[model samples]
Target chain A: MTNRTDFPPPNANQQAFPPPAAGNQVNAQNIQDALEKAVAPKVINTSNNKNDGLNKCPRCGSTEISTQPGTGMLVCHHCRYVFEVAVAVFKDPKELIGEAIGTGAGDITIDETQVTIKCQGCGAEVVVNIEGSMTSRCHWCRQVLSLENQMPNGAVPDVLLPFLLSRETAKQHIEAFAKKRTFYANSHFKREFTTENIIGVYLPYMVVDANVHCDIRGKAGDVVRKYTVGSGDNKKTYYDIDLYDIGRDFDLAIDNLTVEASTDKLNVNNKMNTNNIINSILPFDLENAVHYNGNYLKGFNSERRDTNINDLRGLVDAQVRDVARFKANSTATKYDGGIKWESQDMDTKGSQWLSAYLPVWLYSYMQVKGNGQKLLHYIAVNARTGETMGSVPVSIGRLLFVSSLIEVGLLFLVIIFFLFLVF
Target chain B: MEALFAQLLDSVDLTQVLAVFASSDEDGVGAVLLLLLGGPAFFMFTYMRYRNTDKRHRHEIETPAEMNNLQQYNNFIKHLTRQSSSTITGANDNVVSGSLLSNGGASKSFKAINDITKNFK
Candidate 1:
């Protein structure tokens, strides 16, 4: 909350650059003024450039803009103005297909870790270290500078899904989730649990849309005779089935298959952190995602895509195969007895991989058991759909004790019934 | 042959059987009432028999109709699959990849591709 500066004397650029606009209708001059306010005030660099991640407020000339809580538009802190960024659409299906099956890795492949941007307010050069961060506070003027443009390092994605759940709403959801599991939850966990400690994060993911052609060959069965053999204690049931070769070929159009772009988050091995808890909250509204703007990530934590498209291609293919199998199996639900798929082949005719950031509010804990083993637990709420999921550590002894009491009570009732019947 | 026929007729004793019922005793009336009323036990047994018979008849009528409906649904799925084959032929030429790079402009052809692909799923 400190707004003090010791780097340099304040200049004209340090003053609120663009005065608030008089009315609602924004024009070319307003945007130019906003850009000038975001960059050096004296420099006139006008070249019709695209604003992929840079967000400047045309109304107030304030760079302290963030995604308005529970809304899709960005709000300027200085002027209380709301606005939206233009989303890019891929209209060509063929282009998607090529990129899906493309031999190249992906579109943006930069590996730079640092960049210097000149402060628009004071004409001061500010070096921003983006090693594990997306935004930095200006050292001289206390202005928040964010990654506002697309770069080669793949730090910025093509799309951004702003948070729809505010921090307060997320805290309430987390508390309610923990309250339900408190009966068998470890006492230590209950004592230490705090929803205020939650962090809002924008995790990286790749949204894939595919036009697939599937060919499935398998053997299915029909139950002809379902009869019991033997009698009483020796009785056993058997099924006599008739099997036949079945094949199906169909074209499928799939939209929005999300895969984790970070390697650490994708690792679901329970021996480590509760990584599966995050993966379980997936399936964001990729369809409604808007263009990327660093302003959306101003107040929250963010991660860059470390895993490449080629690295996660196998996972995507497996997901496509699973979906295709599910569709093919729909026709065979009539085989109530049982059906087995011997083989299936899915050919990807077209697929498009797009990069985006999805919002999540997460509260994580490390639950250490009596056996000296440590386990991580997380309760996460999806920012867009408000879907929540978590793993709560429970006391095994407590559960066993409750179950045993119920079993003893049932046994006592059985004894009383037998005694009454004999009398 | 006449003596043999007489012997067979005498063994019947029709008058002896009539004397036992026509004596007008109380036991004879009771026996007649038992045969006429048939008792609650006998009625219950007969009612259960009819109910079981009706249940078997209803089951016999329903089994075949359920089997026929399942078979009809199976046939419908096959028909749908067959009809979809024709639509697959014209899809190859329309196959194209969508791009975020060209998102700034509104291309009618791209919108057409998106519309067509969305319809298939």
Candidate 2:
């Protein structure tokens, strides 16, 4: 396991950028200004504050002043003053910068203990730590700093959800999951079950919220068939179904629908990420999610949330459809047929992006076969509650027990069918 | 192919021909066979050729169990995730920059999330 203090081998051919200055920098005002900007980073063009900070062109204190991006500064058109954009100066060596990155998701300001990226719309400046935190954003900008390129080192994250539950936990989960498959599996696999390597990975996922309305219309009918062939002992019963003209409409709000976006590595959409165990470990009490802080990340390696807003669209739809189907279900015995969707009304209200380090205990073991290898990685326990979900590696002991019982059950079922048919 | 048959159908009355086929009469046998043979032969030949090619393929015969299973599973998931081939193109070269992101001491999202969720975002 890589220790926290050890930095990974940096890639060769990587371009190097300078770090921030060294000093006891104090500015309660700077801190407050940064703090306010952290939460409220956008300047309203029509609102009163639009002109609140609009003082005379500091160049000549001229009341008729305009602000625009100069080569490396915010140029006051009236006085032609060029003060470098000093706030939210990410990774660059200087706490101050010579230019403005623009009206992004937010404005960020630098501080000794943390870097605050303020959301332009909100006042929250996401503050991240230097050591373990691997992502950062203006708490206010809501625009993520971690997802972009060329961000300053250590300017990234404040906290991480470390890898916990170790390798042993994964072994147990895989063994249990495998037991159920032992009965009909090719059999050779059962005999050669050996856990040589279990690789642990923190898979990536994006959870979302959405409100949807659905309208469905369809034509359906009841089906019934009866056959009678008779000699004294050759009579048959009837098979029947009662269907209907079905129509349904439903409205639902789904929250935190998770999906994976990475092409390689561990994707939540991968078969390995089967959604079974992940779902079994779900309902992360997202409602209880607090403002993120590095302190809570004291012990955990977290994978960054690579999936952004765009990736969550389909995931949200799937989750919405799931609930929509359920909501459309009615206990009437007659409604069985295809339903066509005529229209779907959907909209998102107040989309707030959140970055939470979900907990998971993962264990992985790669097994080698004739000429290839298979990785048996397991998401063992619900990181938050330690609940065991499911497993893939079937234990020999479990296999013997399960298969023997299954074989006995099949034997009995066949016997019962034989008696009913032959007698 | 159905459309090709449909074009043959535009001027002709298929229902009348189908009615003769449905009669189960000795006199209609030849006409019924004539109507059914065309559609069935074209479809059956197409299916047989494809099935033969598939059976002759190398990978299905020689691929290892694990690799085959992984491939099948990946195909199933990409279908489920609804990721198109276009979305996957050029995905390899881009990587997130951890260093530049982690710079500026600490106002990044990792901290913001922790901070707000300290109370919950």
Q: Please name the candidate that would achieve the greatest TM-score relative to the true structure.
A: 1
- Residue-wise C-alpha lDDT for candidate 1, range A106-207, written one tens digit per residue: 444777788777666666777777766677777788777776566656677767789999999999998987887777676788899998789998888877
Indicate which candidate wins on lDDT: 1
The iRMS of model 2 comes to 25.3
True contacts kept of each: 0.00, 0.00
Any runs in candidate 1 off by more than 4 Å, and if so which? A1-54, A92-95, A100-112, A224-230, A240-242, A410-423, B1-121
lDDT of 2 by residue, A90-129 (tens): 2211122111111111122332434444433455655555
What lDDT does candidate 2 reach at residue A409? 60
For every candidate, what is the interface RMSD in angstroms?
A: 31.4, 25.3
Candidate 1: Cα lDDT at A63: 79
